[model samples]
Target: MNTTRKLLVLASMTSLVTGCTSLPPDAGFDEVSVNVEQRIANKVHWYTGGEEDAQVRQSIHDRLAQPLTADSAVQIALLNNYNLQAAYADLGISQADLVQAGLLKNPVLEMTRLKPRNGEDASLDIELRFEFLDILLIPLRKKVATQQFAAAKQRVTATVLDHAALVRKAFYEAQTSQHMEDMFREVTSSTEAALEAARRLRKIGNITAGTFDRFQLSHDETRLSLAQSEMSNRASREKLNQLMGLWGEQTQWLIEGGLKPIPFKPIDVNDIEKRAIANSLDLAILKHDIEALAERSGIENVKSIIDDLEAGYAWDRESSGEWSDGPTIELRIPIFDFGHARRARVAAELKQLQDSYYARAIEIRSSARALSDRLQSSRAMVEHYIDNILPLNRRIKDNELLNYNAMQIDVFKLLRAHEKQVASRQLFVQALRDYWLARADLETLLSGRANTVSDMRGPAISMGGGNEGGH
Candidate 1:
């Protein structure tokens, strides 16, 4: 009997020491790295910070090579971003917890000996028993775990959508900065030529000193403006790199050309509202949170403060060569703290959830309405710029240039006309950008198909057929 006891102790110790079990290895490290490298090389540009180069291009293509139209950017974010990847790891941990929650409790092993004061022999006994929660509680625990997992998934999805929207906005802003930089370069060159012409005219007594001074001032201002625009362009590029998860000086920078410019398609508010109701990830996450709250409420209602019930079977042998076998049952009675506070807290949380859902609904509706109105206004502004303002400004600038060349007006008038022309063009670009972004915002709120600029028409996506475009 002593031998058997020693053997059992050794066995338990061994099991405890080696408690952790190994799972099958996932994809091999070299294979995964190769896949990542291949994806980067062939797919999309991956930029984090600094200038763009071949390495960054390979990284982005590997990770984001697939078309991430504004509509699909959210999906890409969830699938590719490091943050979303971390969230997926959390999902695995939660699943493990769920498995534990549904598991049966291991048996308790007990050993004890009772000695008789006047007896020569001592009787030894052993007990081994297992207990499980009532079957009724099983479903409740599962429900709690299920709700938690659902909430986690929803959070990940919402995060993806938010990041995608940010990427689209930043991408467009960077492109705008690039365009402005190009314009500044052209303007500076033009100013330099005008300044040289003014100097020549003044030396030949064809222009006065004031004309030369104004020309020099314009040239200097244009140089300053060019420098400022270049700086801004660099800043915008860095921001895009940050969004693409590029860090350090490891990658190169470049915003690819071929952004399709399209006319804004008018959308009805009623249709948009319906789409928002059906497709909003924010709304879906809120609904999941409410369900999680409901589960927490259930957990509180059934939780026991002190009372517990246990029943199991045991067998033991005594040192005196006698054996005993029977079932054991134990019950704990509550003496104080009967779980009322826990129940109250859970009830309060449920109420809070109710309030939150209503607030979210109201906010979403209000946002949708406001975006719809802005979209209409922006479209009108875009039309006005395209059909009236831009055409008239270009014609006036051309006529002014002809008059200046004919020597009908002084150099100062020509300089003023150049400034006017540049300002008019800038305003036109701003109006067009406003229309594009307003439409993007409207689509974002309404969960429409027109969320990205790329979808305003570009090359078709190879996988997951959907509207693809970047604004």
Candidate 2:
């Protein structure tokens, strides 16, 4: 073809493809929503401060209007948490990459003029060059990018589900601490009043100084326990605040409800092992990565042997008014490198991902079983505190009160019974908290993500059960 015709065709190609932009409207965000739909139905918002973003802000405000339950907390986090919004940027970047992958490299043009030795009309040359290989590889590049985009969406979904679980954990922690604080306050008040009675009894010679001192000690310990509970309540409140992305006045939000009672029915774990493995987001991401690597390996295999194979149109005008125009070709011969090193690198990475996938599956199965055991064990602890310990303490408290009223026992003995009952209640609060925490962790592992192995143990706090015979 003539130089002018070739130039016109290349220009036309660039324009046509320019209008063929491949960006998705919301860039696979809806797909991410679908991925996490099972875990949360809350709509996520990327806060870019437009009209839609304004609507999202209003939605968040409405959800945060009341005291937060677990669902509302997750909803607000999905819409308003800055980190979750930041996570959406991965989708944006990957979509941009996909768009870039489908596009051809911009055609390159070169022009020059040179006078011959005889000072003839300056010889003119013009060439338009582009990678034909890029045209052949567009589909492969898109395949690779599509897989990477899939991995990105899975990762974001995993992040969303994990954050929801974490918020649930934080909510329970906050509620448990609040309950603990209230219970300890009552214990402190009862102990303080009993101490006052003990002073009177000792002054009247109804009790020894040692007995009065013991009551004083009990009151002091109750005060200490109350203080510790107050600290825990404040700490847990701050953690929930952080997770919910609240600050300033927003930090004053309250939890709506308390933890539920432990159920006697155990959770069914018959297929949980296989289910966790199947639903694992980490495993899904690895599969995408491996597929992406496979596509990349195909590209590298070609590129390693022939890194650059560019073809173009060349035009020249000589001094004698004669013009020459023809096609031009370019290739980079691989003299030192035979693609062995690149093939080895791709093979190693593919194998690494394969091994990681298997390892993750095994780890997930074991964690599922361990967390299942932890959940049942937590229920048992709560039941034990209620059935074996608290009821017995309540009976002891009733008998001691009757004896004291009949003047058959000292006030100190009656105070000891009251302390034991309060101690049982304290243990019950701890067991209840641990039970809920355990359940949250187990549920998260089953659905949130695959890489995590949560610690089954609860935090070591003051067990504050007065077993001092009197305490």
Residue-wise C-alpha lDDT for candidate 2, range 73-185, written one tens digit per residue: 87777777789988899899888877777777777789998888876778888898877777667777778888888888888888888888888888888888888888889
In order, what lDDT does every prediction score?
Answer: 0.57, 0.78
- The whole-model C-alpha lDDT of candidate 1 against the native structure comes to 0.57
| Model 1, span 1-471: residue lDDT tens | 254565476447535533443322221222322333332221222223437545544544554544334433333333345764454454456555444445444456788777778774677666665433332354565566566555555444444444556666676676777777777787787788888888889999998999789889989998999999899988976776666556665235345542335455567677656666566555565566566556655655555542355665555656566776666777666667677776676667667666765765666666677788887887788778778987887888788889989999866567666767777766766676676677667755654222331211111111111111111
TM-score of each: 0.74, 0.90
Instruction: Choose the strongest candidate by TM-score.
Output: 2
RMSD after CA superposition, every candidate: 10.7, 11.1
Give the top-scoring candidate (lDDT).
Answer: 2
Give the TM-score comparing model 2 with the true structure, all chains together.
0.90
> Where does model 2 exceed 4 Å of error?
13-19, 50-55, 116-119, 202-211, 451-471
